[model samples]
Target: MSLIHCPECGNEVSTEAVACPNCGRPLAAPAPTIQRRVIVAEPRDDGFPKWVIAPIAILGIVVIFLLIAITRNNEDEANRTVNVNLATQRRTAEPRDAARDTSPPNRIDVPSSSTTVNPPAPPPSAPAPSYPSSTTTVPPSSAQTVPVDRASVVIDAKIATGAGAIQSVKNEKFYLLDKDLDAILADADLEPIEGNSLADSFGLAVLYPDRYGDFRRDALAAISKHIKYNATTGGDGRAAIKNVEPDSYYLFGITKAKNAFAVWSAPVSITAGENKLNLQPARLNEIAN
Candidate 1:
């Protein structure tokens, strides 16, 4: 059972006794078993101060947001530092990449500090040498010296000549047969034969003038077997003789015989009025026979 105190006067009261027995004031009927509560102050319906509560909540939210922003900023700063480091490393390695492409001799050393960037000077290029590209002409194979038993002569018969028969002869296909017109005419004390066929092959005849007397006539007449000379035309009655030296007259016949013919050979020099010739043994036999 619960006990209750009297409300009017200082007294003890049972939860079942509502009135005070001592006071007997009116002895209100025994109060009910339920105790009545006393009302001292009325309850108010007002809330906490708006200004203080709003600022505190706002401050808490701001503190959480600032922590997140600081964490993100730190992360971004770390990434930027890494990127910068990587770029610096790439820049430092650029020279090594170029050196690998170049030759070993052309490679240059790098400085120890990577922060100091520099471009190296280019290497010198090798010089090119100049050379000849033109060709030299070689001499003919047959332009060498060789022993000869006979002489060869080319007669251009288009010109004129006066002799027994101007003919060209071959000395074993080696040397050319030639004579000296000045010397021959001077020794004989005769004028140079006009229209002489020294180079003519045909259409003209050569005659020995009587300037050297019978000795010259005999010397020429003793020869025979005269062949006609021609450059490209066929041989006619005329023959071409070559003038090699002025002191010599080439003989065309073996002996002085009428209607006898002989190929012309190189002339030899002789004293004035001299009739003998220093001829090859084969030629001498041919002339004598």
Candidate 2:
């Protein structure tokens, strides 16, 4: 314990005393002050971290797996469909392949050493070529080139309309018909209407319009065989036909004027490349009767 002298009594006293005891003066030292601080927590912007992440992650994985499985299933179905189609096509083609395989197998002869064989001599000269006449008929071929070696012809013909005498036979139809073909219309089959032979443009197209479609279709089918080729003239009396074979054919057509209808029937011989036949059917120009 430390001692300090009291000011009033000049007596000795302990430093811890609030007052001097010797002089009867009270002396208590002030107790030391202590301060405490309390910390306050603020609410967070995001919700509490109580949500389980593992379950959500597992659910997402399951959904992804299901989507993958569905995609694989769709792919499998498409592949199966394609495979089925390919199998069907193969089945369809097998018959065609079998039909085409009809030729007999090649014969391989083994000559014995004891036997002697001789090769036949080739012919001295080939036979002369026989060309198709007007009556000669050719079977239609699978390919176009063999039927007609791209032969073509263009014919422009006018009609005598009296005073003017020569007028363009407007909008006429021409057919290079294989007259020899059995499919061709015979002369007896041509019916006359209003003085116009069914062969005339007005008679065929205007009088019996319903038959025109069938006639046109039939004419085209005879390319190189029956109705070899056909064409339609514009305002001018001109028609271009590509049915030129190196054979003979019949140039047949129908044209018209104001009061007169004309039918053109003439035998034409087409040479190799290009051939044009001038039609002058003045006798048949008698007014459509």
Best by lDDT: 2
Reference-based TM-score of each model: 0.20, 0.35
Highest TM-score among the candidates is held by which one? 2
lDDT tens readout by residue for model 1, 1-289: 7665666675776656656776643334554598799989988857876778889999999999999999999999999999999999888767655543342211111111111111112226422222221222221121222112222232221111124233322221111223332233344444322332221111012211222235334333322122222122123212222322223334322211222212234543322211122222221111111
TM-score of 1: 0.20
Model 2 weakest lDDT span, ten residues long: 110-119
What lDDT score belongs to each candidate, Candidate 1 first? 0.33, 0.52
Q: Give the poorly placed runs of model 2, Cα more than 4 Å off.
A: 1-149, 180-183, 187-225, 281-289
Worst 10-residue lDDT window, candidate 1: 108-117
List, residue by residue over 71-181, the lDDT tens digit for candidate 2: 999999999999999999889867755543452322212111111111112235523222211322222221222122445566665665545465655566666776832
The per-candidate count of clashes, in order, stands at 43, 6
Clashes of 1: 43
Clashing pairs in 2: 18-27, 18-28, 19-26, 19-27, 195-288, 195-289
